[model samples]
Target chain A: MSESAKRQSALGRMMLDEAFEARVRSEPARVAEELSLPLSFVLELAAISAERVRAFRASQRHKDAVRGGKPPTKLRW
Target chain B: MPRASVGIGLRDAYVEPLRDLRDRRALDVLEVMIDDAQFDRRRMDAWRSLGQRWPLVAHGVALGPGDAIGLDREYVRAVSADLAAVGARWYSDHLCFLRVAGERGPIDLGHFAPLALDDGDLAVLRDNAAALREQYAGTFLLENPADILGFAGQGDAHGRESGRRYTAALRACAAGALLDVTNLALQARNDGFSAGVFLDELDWDRVVEVHLAGGRRSGGLWIDSHDHPVDEEAWALLEHVARRADNLRAVIIERDDRLPTLEVLLDEVAHARRLLP
Candidate 1:
């Protein structure tokens, strides 16, 4: 990954699409002004949101496992 | 020199084998995952018998103390009762939130998630950790989970955030740390930093325990699967921690997937004994 790519938040990479990145890059000042937060805060919020989404998905998977939605267990090396 | 007690996670898959080991007094402590096993009726009786022989530590995955909404009181009370019954040395959980309110009720993420290395995350951990320490007896240690995916803006510039967050969390909560050596190696592998660099930034005085495990690299990121044997990188990190962390007392090998035979697990435990101070 490029240095800039590495700097992009994990949430921005995983959850946000290219269009969102393009918008942020194109009008960072306007976007930051509209959000009433720094551009860095916007990225931070996205990262936090990504973590929340991960927790929610993991919770659903656990619920499914509890309800016997998983396959039979077996050991695989 | 204070030496660290070497043990393994008493997973259900290895319970019978561990029982044999327990009878022989081959292990020091068995870190039991609190939510993975039951603690009533015959099971409780069985645990009481085992508790008489071997030391057990309660490790939690679903407690999610880092949740903004505060930890679940019911869960804390239940864990306390179970640990007391088993005579556990301490209780610990990852420094991340697992559950959040859903439409129905609380949803528990079975996996340990990562928290943002920031001030807001630090506040949540500090508050919840203090509350957990108050509600539960014995020691409460916090472990840093694997940061497989390097979060946004936490590249070279923000690499120091992790150590900063860990330092602040320990200082604010005044709790011990369960430093998972393998997780640190995994993070360092994926995030382009040496594990030692991250270790150097932590307040080693707060670390009370260490965890070593095996992991695999997929898509250039190392995942802490705990299925394979302990690798060299993890062992090197464990050695580094042993040399620096003066307060370290316990070292555990966590193997949940593809568990090998009892002999093989014991070999890993022996390896830990050789590396620890």
Candidate 2:
């Protein structure tokens, strides 16, 4: 995953975590605001943590590759 | 005496058919796949309306419960919110971890790469289960993910019977099992084990639900693609399990990528109904 893709992935994870934290902590309004999303968006994807982890990992790899003289690959998810 | 009375895997194409089923009750339930929030909310009202009358189970694909790290509470919370919206009876995910520790990063599809079992893997599974139980507060069904034959050159004192040990460890921690019949069939064909025997080895009592999908033999192995119709042999096993296990909750038919028509999906459901005792 490229650096930009990595950033997007982090943002996605951040968005998802926002949603998860919002639900788990019982703070729907906060989750909604952080996600910049509506009430329903906060609900469907809250507990799904793996996708973000994969994206995060991909991004970290992108950075390492750049430092070690390797080209970047785009992240699909 | 039978499989959750009746059930179906929630599919995009079948929404209209399910809405139609609301008329004559051709379906009893739909296991909603919470792959994305955007896709789910679009059908939220309709899904809610369907579930009010018919039962629904929230089946998640990205819990990463098997990851060897702290639980992803964020993802769990997201799915929970959606399930609550639809009033789902329970929720589920795969037994395999989707993320793995990479060189200065995590590797996707790392779980598929077979390796020697270490204490860390087992610990992750236990924590994953406890975390899932904590997040959902209901039955957490962990599914058997698709696997391929690879020695993966594990270190000594790690590999021998790694597959069985890893799966057994997860079963020990999981609240219930979501054994995919097609996965067993594919594994049996590709991995040189009898599918029937494999199913027999499972903790049948803990098997709350059954997943049925179609696969085709490909690239020296059978791939568990949910695109086509459920195969005959796998369907037979479903019937057998329905007869053997008294606590079977539901039988879900899953299809992804290439979706079949509504009539075809309903026919598969009808086939399952006929097989049920």
lDDT of 1 by residue, A1-77 (tens): 22221222222322223455454556666656764556774554344433434433443343334321233222110
Top candidate on lDDT is 1
**Candidate 1 structure lDDT:** 0.66
Per-residue CA lDDT of model 1 for B1-277, tens digit only, reads 6687888887555666656763454678778777654433445555566676677787876687667657888878777788787788888878765554333444444445566645666677777777776767588888888764465334443456677677777776677899988887777766776666566679988999999888775544567767689899888888888998888888998876677887788888888888876
- Badly placed stretches (over 4 Å) of model 2 are A1-77, B38-40, B110-119, B151-167
Instruction: Let me know the TM-score candidate 2 reaches against the reference structure.
Output: 0.70
DockQ of every predicted complex? 0.08, 0.02
| Regions more than 4 Å wrong, model 1 | A1-77, B22-25, B38-43, B103-105, B152-157
**Count of clashes in candidate 2:** 14
The sequence of per-residue lDDT tens digits that candidate 2 reaches over residues B1-277 is: 6446556777666677767654546767788776444444676776787777688887875566656644567767777777777788878877655554333465443223222234555666777777766667777787766554322222222222433553576565766777787876665565465655555456667778889988764444556656578888888888887887778888888876467776677788788889888
DockQ of 1: 0.08
lDDT of 2 at B86: 79
lDDT of 2 by residue, A1-77 (tens): 32222322333343224444346337655666754555544443343244433333443343234221223432333
